[model samples]
Target chain A: DAGVTQSPTHLIKTRGQQVTLRCSPKSGHDTVSWYQQALGQGPQFIFQYYEEEERQRGNFPDRFSGHQFPNYSSELNVNALLLGDSALYLCASSLGQGVNTEAFFGQGTRLTVV
Target chain B: AQSVAQPEDQVNVAEGNPLTVKCTYSVSGNPYLFWYVQYPNRGLQFLLKYITGDNLVKGSYGFEAEFNKSQTSFHLKKPSALVSDSALYFCAVRDMWKDTGRRALTFGSGTRLQVQP
Candidate 1:
């Protein structure tokens, strides 16, 4: 089965510009989560969407938001991006919101802010 | 709060030798632990996970992890290292009791493993 897929393997945007990254969940998976990985650092949770509704969010600001479609595809939108927003945007999918479920990740979208 | 720490920045080992990448986690209540490996320019691949049952969990790539509750550590080990096994390893954890509706993985900084001939 096709695994989680993310588009625009690489992206470049200027400061204050907005960027949108897309993700298609793995086949048969429903929940989708987003993470931000800075250079040389571990990924930080951005938010999660389930059943077409946002389920949980991390410490990120309002500038970062996400949407999940009925087809289980998700989109990450960053508005008025800052230099610090330059990072790898990763998308992961799981069966449900449970501790035992393992998340399948996409190759990730590398966002470069100039 | 849940967090993970990979003690080593890099691990070097011979092709035939055993390898160990250490990881420690901090989380309240029962913890769901996981190990993933990433090759150059690739996404993270799930190696294994510790949910319950036996302390020893075997996963893909002939890799296994031992979960030590008292020490709050889950260390990944391989009996014989392969040159192709070289990659970046990450440890992650999340509390089972969190009300956050979705399970989020708290990842470590990652440890690079280099296997030589």
Candidate 2:
């Protein structure tokens, strides 16, 4: 089975520009979550989408939002991007809603804000 | 608030030597702990988790973690280090806030492991 897949392995955008990163969760998974990983840092939770609705969110601002489709794919949209937004955008998928379920991750989209 | 701390930013070990990446956590109630590894330019891979059971939780790639409730720590360990094992390691805690329906994994700052051949 193919693992979680993300598009645009790398991208560069200017400040205030909007960007959308896409992700396809692993087959048989139902939940998708987004995270931000700065250079030399661990991935930080952004939000999670389950059943086409945002179920949980982290400490991120309103500029960060996401959507989940019926096929369990997801898109992470960042509006009014800032310099600090330049980081690796990661998408992880899990099979269920429980806290103990293991999550499979995508390679991530590297967002570079100039 | 729930949080995870990986005290070591980097760890170096010779091949065939045992390695340990330290992690400590703070959370109310029983904490669900996890360890993940990320290689260069790749995403995080689940290593192991501690829900309920033995203190030592064995996981993928011959890795294991020790969950200490009293110490509030879950440390990852490998019996023998391999060069291919060099990567970034993260410790996470599953949390749920009282006033919010937010239940997700919170990660540590990460620890980079360098295995020397």
Candidate 3:
């Protein structure tokens, strides 16, 4: 079974440009969450999608948004990207929104904003 | 709010010796804890989790973590270190009672482990 898969593996965009990152959750998972990991730092939660609706959101600004497809896939969109937005965008999947479920992660899309 | 802390920025150990990477967490109510390791350019790989039962949880790569409720710490340990084991280790936690915190895991800053020859 393939775990969570995200694409494109790496991306580069200029300031004020928008980019969309896609993710396909692991075959038996129903929930998808996005995280951003900057260099030398831990991942910060961006948002989560379940049942094709946004279930939860972190402290990110409105510039960041996401969507979950009916097929359990998800997409993360960042508008007017800032140089600070350059980081590894990670996608995690879990069976449900419960506390006991362990999340499986993707290799992540390394975004570089110039 | 829930949070995790890896006290050490880096841990160095000799190959073949026992290694420990410390992690402490803060959360209200029952806590669900996890440990993940990351290679150079890979995603965070789940090592183990502590949902309930067994303070000692054994996970992949012969890694085990001991959950101490009183200390609010979940430190990862390995009986013997290998050069290949050197990587970034992270500790994460979820508060079961929080309506919002349950949806995501809060991770620590990460500790780099270097197993020397």
- Candidate 1 chain A least-lDDT 10 residues: A37-46
DockQ of each: 0.79, 0.85, 0.86
| Candidate 1 chain B weakest lDDT stretch, 10 residues | B94-103
DockQ of 3: 0.86
Worst 10 residues of 3 chain B by lDDT: B94-103
Model 2, B2-102: lDDT tens per residue? Answer: 89999999999999999999999999878999999998889999999999999999999999999999999999999999999999999999997667845
- Ranked by DockQ, the better of candidates 1 and 3 is 3
Between candidates 2 and 3, the TM-score winner:
2
Q: Give the alpha carbon lDDT tens digit for every residue of B43-104 in model 1.
A: 88899999999999999989999999999999999999999999999999974435644467
Which of 1 and 2 is the better model by lDDT? 2
- Residue pairs whose backbone atoms clash in candidate 3: none
Specify the highest-lDDT model's number: 2
Give the per-residue lDDT digits (tens) of candidate 1, residues A1-114.
999999999999999999999999999999999999898877888999999998888889999999999999999999998999999999999998888999999999999999
lDDT (Cα, 0-100) at B113 in candidate 1: 96
| lDDT at residue A9 of model 2 (Cα atoms) | 99
TM-scores, in order shown? 0.97, 0.98, 0.97
- In angstroms, the error of model 2 at B3 is 0.5
